[model samples]
Target: MNVQSKYSILVFNRENELFLPLTEFYYYQQKRINESSALSYLITLERFFSWLAKSSNYQGTRVKWSDSHMAIRTAVENYLIYQMGCKLRSKENFQYVIMTKKSPQTINHFLAAIKSFYKTALHLKLYEFQNPLVDADYSISIGSFSPTSIRENKPRLPKIAGTEIPSDSSYRSQSDSYFKLVANDWKPNIIADHDLPYIIYRAGSEIGWSLRDEVVIRMLFETGARINEILELTLGDYRQRINQYEIATLNKGSEKRRIKFLRFSQDTLKLLMRYVNGERKTYAHEKQTFTKLSDSEVIFLTRRGDPYNYNAFYSQWSKIITQAKIKMNIHKTRHWFVTNMIRNIYDTASDGGEIEMKKNELINYMKWKDPETIKVYEHYFNEALFREIHENMAKKMQEYEKEYLKKSHSSSEGEQLSSSVLQTKAILPTEEIEWINEFYKGME
Candidate 1:
């Protein structure tokens, strides 16, 4: 990756100069999409621009943001080809290798960014020529029906297939399917609800636990929110009296922003209060000691009191899972939350119309415009199915525990395992709740 590429895409040049074209394009995007989504599009543009700087066949050694239409067009095509794992026939192309491959969904995102960039450029009269991506292009087609994974018992979305298009004078004219890239065979990992308490217990453990990290974990599990949405939370957005936090997250595939309210459980609320009043304040003071402080109202902060970025939060989560010895991603918690919420909100024993009403309510809560998206979790639609799956999961978890113990016994040195890792029901005790109540009472 180019050093300049790491910077925000809003920086149009290596000299940190702003290019009016991209600035105008970004503002145009902001009008239609959320700020984060707009910024992501710009970030994609940055990556493409960085690749153009090094790639051969462009007229100049240095490609400016305001390069000619043909140059930019050719670069866009070549970049897509390169991302699809084709070698570029250029002298300077030897500087790079196809070690890492991009998924179809990722390439589609790149395509979207480039297309949007040129579209905006044309709209703003920055580019007089036709849009580069006006020709036939690659798009991922996730079919109507998804197949269930026998191993995980969850839906695995089908791979991306090329959209059959009539040949024309523009790009991808000949056998566009020949340039097929494998799409993401995405399988939603669902964490069993029985194991959730143990995960939360480990997250909030006294040893090596960061209260901020714990709060974020608990919030994700409880709210079924995307990590970015949760990270966007601020002190101003939080309503302590209502035990809710409101966030305006970008809804996928649309121009609208979804306003979501994350209602916290009583335990999570207590932990959040403790973090805000105690550890976070210390972090803020430490940050002030090193540098001039600004009145940033962002809720979750690093030890240095800087607001949590994705990479920093991911690193913290990595540490959390490593200590907990779990083979699950942070995203699995969302699946768990969503499935459980569905189970709770819609009882199968209820009338048919009531089910539809509850489903509509869930769709509204999740801020989903399309009802079909909820079909992915269709397996957990009923109480009977949920119970069966839960029972099977409990058995599987026991077998996994036994296998884990057997491996531990065979290790060079036998160490006693933490109950938070080995046990499924490691919830907080009555006295601990009493202690939390008393502690907050004194603070009040």
Candidate 2:
């Protein structure tokens, strides 16, 4: 039999041995319109089965048909707790790991994924008993003294001239206003125009542009979605409306929500359209796609016309940012859009009443549940925009000091070395003591 047929047989055998009704559930998932999501669910369930078989807690004990639910739940909960602990300890070694520093969102995603798996396992009668894992509460302790302790333990680097000072307030204000302008300008345009986004794409392509990069940048700018939300978009998730686009899906924490894009540029829509029609369609025809690709049939494709992975997407985005002369990080682009939008709202509102009116107007306009979210973009308006100015100043000062030292040393070499050197050294004063002598103190 072929590899796929052999694999299917193995999976079937395992399913039967485990007494899991996984095949039917898998079929149900594949039948959903959002097949990508169905596939992810299946893959997660498959992992659950694999973990159940290998788990020390589950080994040798035959899962009674009635105890299946309890067995699966207990297995999943134990696995999640073990994984979370492993992640926390691994943080010291893998500092760049994104979720190393836990956030509410990160913890929630982890819990939700495990919770969903147990719920599905229970439904499928994978075990004989109700899932014990379901009864466990997800809790994390953020130590009260942790932040201050960490700060104390961390080594501080000497301040260098060119490095920008880390001022959170200033950065936030600037970023908030930058994107508002871009979004409002494109609000009146058709999404199919394809000019603006293409210009951005081409300009950014020196680093590299994949189909997903094009779609992501466009979506962020057009829809004002967060980077995580943009990354989550799949082909089946977006719906075109009369004047806007509606993205209906689960966000980071599996919370289903709808976000509306009022004025998607025609350019962005056309690029996405072309990617779906040309790139993704061709990949599906070739049948060389990965499991994720086959399941999602997403709009954005890799150069090989497969579904885009996060690492590859980030690498490409970093390259684009460098090529485009954009001094901001990838997430900064999202900030750029939001900041500009808020600024425009602030500017267009009536005088004196501007802040109050604009705040209320944006609440309705953007459907923001909390006005405090707007504070993230406030820095752009508060300061001047300059690149490497402080760094340059620092370098120049260091150079001047070096040149002065060189000149002083050269002059000293021409005279009686010890006396002249000491005199010349005194020309450029420093706080450090020149010499220490027990007997010479009174004479000096």
Candidate 3:
């Protein structure tokens, strides 16, 4: 027999089956699967192979390329069951090994891959056994769904603990004090130059990341775009719309939408434009490869000029977060931006007693649907403003009372009314108090 035929026969014999070239079939199957899915299959197969190599059935000898088909199939089935049992016990903390959640989709995928392998072996005449993965029964009750079902049926709302009105002033004071404490406690040891974008870019570069990494980070922080959405961005996704940048792209699940970036993010946008126009354009021109440079080309690229993969970005981000000594994940930068922006909006509204047209336009541009979504910021704003107003009014009233007492030795009815008005306005709005009193027919 020729070298190719001999090698094929040996490969078939190793699995103890007859009639198939497993490696060739695997290559064909891989071509049908996406890169991500193919990688998952390869990982699973490696684990299975490792277990098989360590099994006592092999008798400390390597299984020949031409192994007994029935024996190989039985061994594989036993290994699968053992793995499932182990996984179930591990997930349930050993409390009940038989009552662990086993995903049908995962098991089905494993079975499918193994069945495909056996089919290929049979086609090549390398093995004579029936597909064991398909024949084996995997219908075992791993666990109860009671906990998950209960969680799904539970109501979603914050439970209020007390009847007392939560003073806006008190809330603001507490929030400010808490943020100040946290910020002070976790201050970075290495003082970064506050040149903003330049500092951020250099920090990213220091960690061996490309210019694209800096752009992605800035976009996440400034626009609050989810990480997956940022990865999906293409060169043509961004467009200049008057003073701001509008990014039209698909989100995680391929949901297409538009998001507007404020003028404050201009510097970051400019850097991205520079990188694309200067570096990206030049590289594509020099390479002159079959792939044409277009807006459809991925926005982010690796050092080698290839498209940036999500997994690679995540690994790098974890390391960077650790190095930076950030108490939260990188995604917290997005939360910080959203929270601060809402706080600013609330402050402006409280100061003016109404939302300005310009401020309203900006809020709309950000695509927030409900005013209540910004209520957290309002809570903080109300608390701070109320406290300040009350403290100032109280001090003024104390002065007025002292002056009146010195002149007349007692306050008149009018003086008492004025004092009452000041104190009443300090706590609740005049209109709200009057409405309440009217509704109650003068009840205290």
Better structure of 1 and 3 per TM-score = 1
lDDT score for residue 114 of model 3: 55
lDDT of each: 0.59, 0.47, 0.50
The estimated TM-scores of all candidates read 0.47, 0.40, 0.41
Task: Give the residue spans of candidate 1 off by over 4 A.
Answer: 1-35, 50-67, 78-82, 85-103, 119-130, 134-209, 227-260, 283-298, 301-336, 343-358, 379-444
What is the C-alpha lDDT profile of model 3 across 1-444, one tens digit per residue? Answer: 644543211223335654234456545455553333443454455556556666625444544324665456545545545664322222211111121244222443354455556555666666666544333322324343333222111111211211122233322222100001111111111211234334444556778765667777777767756565677667555542444465665532223554543333677878777767665555543343213446567766665667666556766776666555454444455445655555566556656535555356545544443433444444555776798899999999999778667746576778877876787689898799889889899675
Q: Which window of 10 residues has the lowest lDDT sum in candidate 1?
A: 147-156
* Model 3 lowest lDDT segment of ten: 176-185
lDDT of 1: 0.59
Clashing pairs in 1: none
Compared with the true structure, model 2 gives a TM-score of 0.40
Task: Flag the better candidate by TM-score, 2 or 3.
Answer: 3
Model 2 stretches with alpha carbons more than 4 Å out: 1-78, 86-105, 124-126, 136-217, 225-259, 269-366, 374-444
Which regions of candidate 3 are displaced past 4 Å? 1-208, 239-244, 252-254, 257-264, 279-293, 349-371, 376-444
- Residue 420 in model 2: lDDT: 48
Q: Write the per-residue lDDT of candidate 1 for residues 54-161, one digit (tens) a residue.
A: 663676465555676566656655666665543323322121212234423455456566767877788788887766554444343433322221211111133221
Ten residues in sequence with the least summed lDDT for candidate 2? 177-186
Query: lDDT tens digits, residues 266-348, model 2?
Result: 77777766666665666554543232333344555566756565545666766766676654444445445556666666668
